[model samples]
Target: MGKVTGFLEHQRVKETYQPAEARLRHYQEFVSTLPVLDARTQAARCMDCGIPFCNNGCPVNNIIPDFNDLVYRDDWKSAIDVLHSTNNFPEFTGRICPAPCEAACTLNFNNEPVGIKSIERSIIDRAWEEGWVVPQPPAVNTGRRVAVIGSGPAGLAAAQQLARAGHDVTVFEKNDRVGGLLRYGIPDFKLEKTSIDRRVRQMEQEGVTFRTGVLVGDWPVGSRVGNLSTETVSPERLRTEFDAVLLAGGAEQPRDLPVPGRELDGVHFAMEFLPQQNRVNAGDRLERQIHAAGKHVIVIGGGDTGSDCMGTSHRHGAASVTQFELLPQPPEQEHKPLSWPYWPQKLRTSSSHEEGGAREFAIGTKEFIGENGRVTGIRTVRLAWEGGRMTEVEGSEQVLPADLVLLAMGFVSPVGSVLEAFGVARDPRGNAQASTEEEGGYVTNVPGVFAAGDMRRGQSLVVWAIREGRQAARAVDEFLMGQSALPR
Candidate 1:
């Protein structure tokens, strides 16, 4: 700890955001990082508990206390070193991660936790500015080649670790650009593309090859999700050429509402709507897009993707925006006593929620009403929950006007075709079948094939994806070399 009584002396500080009105006008990042002094004060609030549940709370298992203390002492170089020891991409997590580490802080037992996410962002930002972030190319090439199937955080993290461990690594992204969902799925306002591009440059310098617009296996035909691949490489070719193959592709199959009007013209998946704007922002002109401008938009499923749809709609000057959640609203405040050292369910109001949109809870859409084959309204009903069972409230059906409807429900699994192409086993939940605790962790039933990240764990946070990637790299390194210096 920087001060003997720093936690008692300072209150938790949050990063300031640009006004909703101002931020809604553009798609650039709006949240400002804390100044150095304020960030130090925030770091001082870390109790550096004896157990440090924050380490386990974070998916990457970052050395939280050490970095916090370093930041408090103004030793940013050491802070970045501590941060990089476990995490390959703090900037990605610092911006978008929900910060489970903060929730697990012992301070949350009675008071606000340390601003770990903001302090983390500060450290990485300063490191990038001071040129501390550089390619760590392996001193000697082990001459083992590994092929990573996705360019998301998981694949990127694994590729970096494998490269550093002297393996020749190549990442295949089906999309036209690197960074997979990070470059396409996430809105630019929350994370700029430059954040990902800079890392790609570094990874290239580290001797990792990136093949964009290239698919490693057959993509599902007629699929609307992530269908930008122009070239295909059979898994057989990859297996024959590479020493090991890692499946780090994300779960891209968005869940659907199989209701009466799901096939209506205006009804679309959130993945369909969100990526178009991201492409437009990247200077790619789409002749036609799922435009929300001057239209009544109803986003079903209250999650990050839904919030992203709402924010994009706002930027598109939609006439109105509304979001729906099937479950009843969570409590406004978390009961820290029972939930201490673990994540608690509570209402989270994102910056997009503050951008002027109505939210409906405990409601389910029954059908989409349309006119001339275009969605004109939606039929919805309120729900009543008891004893973990859900029932529709009687006489609760109502019609709400909508020109565009986005299904923001979560993903169910990775594309089945990709897994089938490689003959990798899938779990009961449709994710790739693999074990993390057993020997040869991350290995699939098929030899030389491994799975990690969302492809193995289903939908998850970026931090979790990175963790899976790093751990999977260790497993692959071990399999290849009979021993691995890579940390799990």
Candidate 2:
């Protein structure tokens, strides 16, 4: 610990952000960094908890207390080294992760966590500014070849780890550019593409080869990854060319609302809308862009993806924006005493919601009302939960004007064709079947084939994806070389 009584002497402070009105005008990151002195002061707030629940709370098991002490002691370089010892990308997690570690902080018993996420962001940002971040290429080659499919966090993480382990790693992405969802799914204001570009460059320096615009399955794909490519590489080729193959493809099947008027022109998936804006922000020419200008928009789903759509719509100057959630609204604050260590269920009003958008909960969309093949409005009904089931309330049906409707209900599973193409069995939930046990974890049904990340575990957070990828890389290395040094 930096100081025995530091926690008692300091109070928690977080990073600041630009005014909502100003930030909504452009798709650039607006969060300002905490000053060095203030960051050290905040770092001092970390209590010397004997158990350190933050480690268990974090999916990547970041060394929270050690790094906090390092920051408090002004050991900036060592602090970042400690941060990267576990997490492959602190910048990505710092900006986007919900920071479950903070929730698990012992100080959270009183509802004021140690501000772990902010501290993390400060350390990594400082490292980059000071040029402490650099690539570490392996000294010797293992002569083993590995192919990682998907190019998302999981795939990227696995490829980087394997390459560092002295294996030849190649990542295949269906998109035209690298970074997978980091490149296209997330909006620019939250995490700029530069962060991803920097990491990709570092990975390349570490000897990982990235191949974009290469689909790993059949033609006429229905998902976004499929739409990015004109041709697909058969699984047979992958199996023959690479010593081991890891399927890190994300869950691309979007959950759809198959109500009437689903085929209307103005109705689109959140994926369809989110990626176009990202491409435009990257200076790509979109002949026909999806915009919410002068139109009333309704986004069905209240998750991060939905909020992203809300933010993007505001940037497009939508006439009005409304978001609906089928589940009832959670409490404004979590019951902290009862949920100190677990992820709490509470009202999470994102920055996008603050920008300008009406949000409704416990409402079910009934039908899409359209005119001349375009969506015009949405009919909905109020719902109540009873006996753990949601039932619509009588005499509570309503209609809202909507020019564009986005379905952000989350993903169902990976595309079946890709899984089938590899002849890999899937779990009951339709994900690639892979265990996490020492004996068979991450190994798929087919020999020399593995799976990880959202493709194997279903939709999850970026931190979890990184963990899966790192672990999967170890598994692949072990399979190919009969031994491995990569961390699990």
Candidate 3:
């Protein structure tokens, strides 16, 4: 809108990255933000499309066109204002979000879309550098006390919103640090913990209390693998003390590969392996921390988590890295006509994939080969789909060397104990049962109890989690005060 023919004049400019070899030496953010003029040019590329699909494409419904125009007009302050108006944390999404908004951009019908993600990163980074980002404490106290379970993006967003509504908000986290997966599960190469710390400080100034390393329910039994809770607080205590409780614990129960030799050592869940390295990077000393140094590593599941593992393994000086996907490899590109205005299925090669690794698709693992109680390799078989059934290809069985096997098959559900303690119902897919309706939305079966984010909707993007948290804050506010002014 700032320039009538800006899209035609400028091609999309992407952020530059540090050489993979140089970045692999340490765990730090490697992607460089766009220059100011470049960001402005990208923002200028936002055409005056009558219908702004980018807004709806974004899970948080960010005012994309407004921010783009503001940035293009050299009004960085207003750009950040419009940005923070919707997204509680743009830095996280700007760095990691797949940018479905760009996919839905009208210009993307034929030409390259506006570099929205790069511009977003530039605006927020500038805001922080210029001291434009600061605490916005509420004007008055509402005298309501709210408890938010978990300190991931979802919980943090809800806490900030609820606190701004003049409520006494407290967040509970099972990890030693405030951020849940952001501080542990994710590699520092994408998002540094310092970014999370800055927001945590702002939230504290806004009257939000954080209780870390405290489990809000019974400790998950039988699996000490991923449990980070050191202290326990009974669900009854929270129910009796707080006016309302919001369950925002993320889906943490990782799906497992239960083939033969799964019990062997060195075959670990992605959660277990990832958190260990993250802790190490944070300067925590752990004896026998998992490492990929000089070992043939096989990462199962070709998702973001698997990519993260691949990157981490590369940092660990892995001998060789290989990834596996059960499904057939997707096409290199999508047909725009059929998939316009929505996320498309195509071959996605992450920065980690670009670093170095072998990717095997349409292959299934038959068994794990081990020696002396340790995994040594994996037996695989090629597959073909016929009539909705997978048929093994004859004479296609093979064994691959694997000193370490990381299962990054995504999470199945939240730790059941926490939900069971609150007596929250679960959906067929095992996510916390709740709705997003305006009336009694996010409310669980139990009175004064609500759920949001990954807990309520299952594992999803950080943007979606932030959206759920903000909306659920409004729902909780309405439940306690009978009405709320917070945005959905």
Candidate 4:
């Protein structure tokens, strides 16, 4: 505790954002950092709970209380050290994570959780500015080689840890550049590419070899979601060359809405539309770029991916935008008494929602109405929940004009080709079958083969991916050697 009664004396404060009008004009980060003094005050608001649920709430199990105290005392270097001890990339989580930690805070029982997210962001930003973040090269070589597929958060975390453990680590990515989804799936407005590039540079210094445009699976050009093809690399070559192989490819099998007129020209998946904009933002020439200008856009699904499409459409000057959700709208506020210290079911209005968009809840799409094979409108019907089952209400049908339709419903599972090629057993849910127990954890049916992150588990947050990667690395280290010193 930096201050004994700081939590009682101070109130929680969050970081501010730039004006909507100004921020929408460019694909750059718009979040403004809090003043140093204000950040310290916010950090001081962390109470001394007998049990810190915030630590438990965090997927990476970050030492929240210790970092909060360090920030409160202006020991930013030490704060970043504590944060990096658990999380490999605090900047990424600080910006994009939903911060379940706040919900698990003791104060959240009254809906007044401490500003853990903002304090975390501040600690990392200060660390970078002060040049405290550096590479940690291994002191000795283990004379072993490991191959990691996919350069996303999970793959990067595993590769870095294995490299620091004196194992030769190599990352293979299909994209021309590293960062599988973070490079293309996300927009620059939320996270700039420089953050990834900087870390890549550091990882290089740490002796991690990254081979971009080296696809490990057999896929044709323009077939791997958004006209990006994988670089040809045989699985036989990897197995023969590396001591161990870890598959960290994310769950990329997007759930498609295969309804009437689904093959229309104007209708596309969120993955197709999102990656094009990301490529353009990265200064690549995109032939026949998809734009929402002067069009009435309807985004199907009401999750983070859908919100991202809404924001991108607004930036493209869409004449009108609407988001649809099949489920009923949750209450604006959750009953804290009933859902204390756990993620509650509540209405979440994202920053993109604040910009502009019509949100429809309890509505189900009946069909996609089109003209001459181009999407023109969407026919929908109101829905009601009865006995835990949803049913369409008769005589509540309507049609909304839509020049463009984007399917933003989440992903189903990882692409089966890679897993099948490797002959790894899959769970009932279509993910790689692997336990997290101490024995046989993260080990695939194939010897010397391990799985982690979205590839092993289903779709999840970036923080969870990092945690899985770290744990998987430890498992691999233990399997290679009798005992390991890596953190789990």
What lDDT would each prediction earn against the true structure?
0.93, 0.91, 0.92, 0.89
Q: TM-score of predicted model 3?
A: 0.98
1-488 in candidate 4: lDDT tens per residue? Answer: 54667878988787999999998898899997777898899888888787999999999999999998998899888899999999999999988899999999987887488888888888888888989999999999999999998898999999999999999999998788888788888888888989999999999999999998776765554455346565667677888999889999899999998888888888988988998898998889987998999999999999999999999999999999999999999999999989878999999998899999899999999899998889999999999998889999999999999999999999889989889878889999899988898484899998888999999999899889999999998888888876789998
Q: TM-scores across all candidates?
A: 0.98, 0.97, 0.98, 0.98
Clashing pairs in 2: 435-441
Per-residue lDDT tens digits for candidate 1, residues 154-226, read 9999999999999999999888889988988999999999999999999999999999777667645433334
lDDT of 3 by residue, 5-44 (tens): 8988888888999999899999999999999999988988
Residue 359 CA displacement from its true place in model 1, Å? 0.6
Cα-lDDT of candidate 3? 0.92
Question: What is the model-wide C-alpha lDDT for candidate 2?
Answer: 0.91
lDDT at residue 386 of model 4 (Cα atoms): 80
